[model samples]
Target: MRILVVEDDAGIALGLRTNLQQRGYAVDVCASLASAWAALSSEPFDLVLLDLGLADGDGGDLLLRLRQARAAAPGALPDPLTPVLIMTARDQVADRISGLNLGADDYLVKPFDLDELEARMRALLRRAAGRAHPLLVHGELVVDPAARTVLRAGEAVELAPREFALLLLLLESRGRVLSRQQLEARLYNWQDAVGSNAVEVHVHHLRRKLGEGLIQTLRGVGYFIPREDGA
Candidate 1:
């Protein structure tokens, strides 16, 4: 999954980025609210790790802006229902309630355990994906998002990080087509040099590992996985 970390503390941001990356998540870190806004506006992040105290302004403002974008016209923000996890040193009850009221999925106080953060993130992601369980099943394919494991016909299938991410996205949007631009935004950050055929390469690898019929490409359009009725 792709996660954006908005933290002003250099140490905290570095730690978050490193730990999340090691856990097989694409992470982007920014110190100021302006940078965070730019990143959120440009990319389709699966989740956001926000710190209330930012260099430029309170993260609450950014959270409000995110909600506003979601309430705007269609396509105003990629993934309008994206989850936000607020992390800050403020541990007061009012602070937590305020953040949650502002539409944050979870609130984490500073000096928290990384394991706990990850667990909360997983819960939010599952909720956002409309998944009651960590395991997502479609036909003979079973994907354990938390474990980052895929099983087909009761057999395990190993996949690279990018490949796994791509499959997960497709699974989440099983009946809908995802355009190339949307896939690119979800798969890559601004700093990454995305090749013209990056998504195509990942899709090809996933198909080879899963099945050729798993992902269908629309001519001159996008890609999608057929629903159960094969519509």
Candidate 2:
């Protein structure tokens, strides 16, 4: 999934970006609330890792803005329902309550465990996708996002990071069509060097490894994974 990390500390931001990227997540960093707002105003992000103490403004202001943007014209603003996880040094009850009241989906104090953060992230993403289970299951294809493993026809399938990301995204949006642009946006970050046919190559690889009918194409529109019952 694509993540926007709003943090001011250079060391913390770099560490988060590097670690999350290694876990197959596309991450973008914004050092100040202004930059975070700019990025949010222009693009779509699956989740936000917000830090309360930004250089320019309080992260809660950004959170409130994001939540209040639900009335914008369709596609004109960022998704108001997009999950936000507040990561900050504030550990008091009032701070946690205030952030939650401002539409932060989850909160983690600084010096938290990376594993716990990832678990919380997974939970939020799963809830956003309307899934209750951590494992994504579509017929015989079982995907474990935490484990980064896929089981097809009762056998383990090895997929590259991009391929895995593409598969998970398709599964999450099971009946919905996602254009190449959408796939590319979620699969790669600004720092990655990507080829023109990167999504196509990864889709081909997924189909070959999993099954020919696993991912369906729309010729001109987009791609989608069929609903579980083949709808």
Candidate 3:
């Protein structure tokens, strides 16, 4: 999972980035709301760790803007419904209520335990995806999205970043075909030069890593994972 950390305190931001990275999450840190806005406008993220007090402005404003953008159009914001967790020094009951009312998925005060923060993040992510657990099981294949790890028949499978992402997308959208264009858009950012064969290459790599019949191609349409029931 990818996360954006909006914090002005250098120590806190660095610690957050290091800890989250160690836990298998791709992280980006910014010291101000402006940089956070720019990052949000540019790339997609699975979640945001927002600090209320920033170098330039309050984080609540940014959260409001993000919620507003999500309400405007289908794709107005990257991951329009992306989960947000507020991490700040403010601990008052009203402050917590306000942040929650402003669309913050969860809130954590400073001096919080790293383990608790991680647990909260996982909970919010699972809730956003409408999943009851962090593990996604499809027959003999087990995927832990939070850990960014996959196991096939009790054996761990190592995959490149792109391959893992492709596998995750396919697993998440099982029973539905996803076109090359849609896959490229989700996997690559705007700056990436997506070659015509980019998706095919990744798909090939994934199939080799997993199995031949894992992901089925529908000729000119797209690719999909066969339903677990084999319907």
Question: Which candidate ranks first by lDDT, i.e. highest?
Answer: 2
1-231: candidate 3 lDDT, tens digit per residue: 667889999998889988876665667888998989888887667789999998799999999998877435654554458799999999999999999999999999988999899999989877876779779999889998767788999999998877887787788778889899777766764334779999999999888988999999999999999889885
State the lDDT at 183 in candidate 2.
Answer: 88
Give per-residue CA lDDT, model 2, range 7-89, as digits (tens): 99999999999999999999999998888988988878899999999888899999999999874675565778989999999
lDDT of 1 by residue, 21-105 (tens): 8787888998998988888776678999999988789999989888767436645554457799999999999999999999898
Candidate 3, run of 10 with poorest lDDT = 70-79
Query: Which candidate tops TM-score?
Result: 2
Better of 2 and 3 by lDDT: 2
Clashing pairs in 1: none
User: Lowest summed-lDDT stretch of 10 residues in model 2?
Assistant: 70-79
Off by over 4 Å in 1: 70-72, 78-80
After best superposition, candidate 1 residue 226: deviation in angstroms?
1.3
**Candidate 3, TM-score vs. the true structure?**
0.79
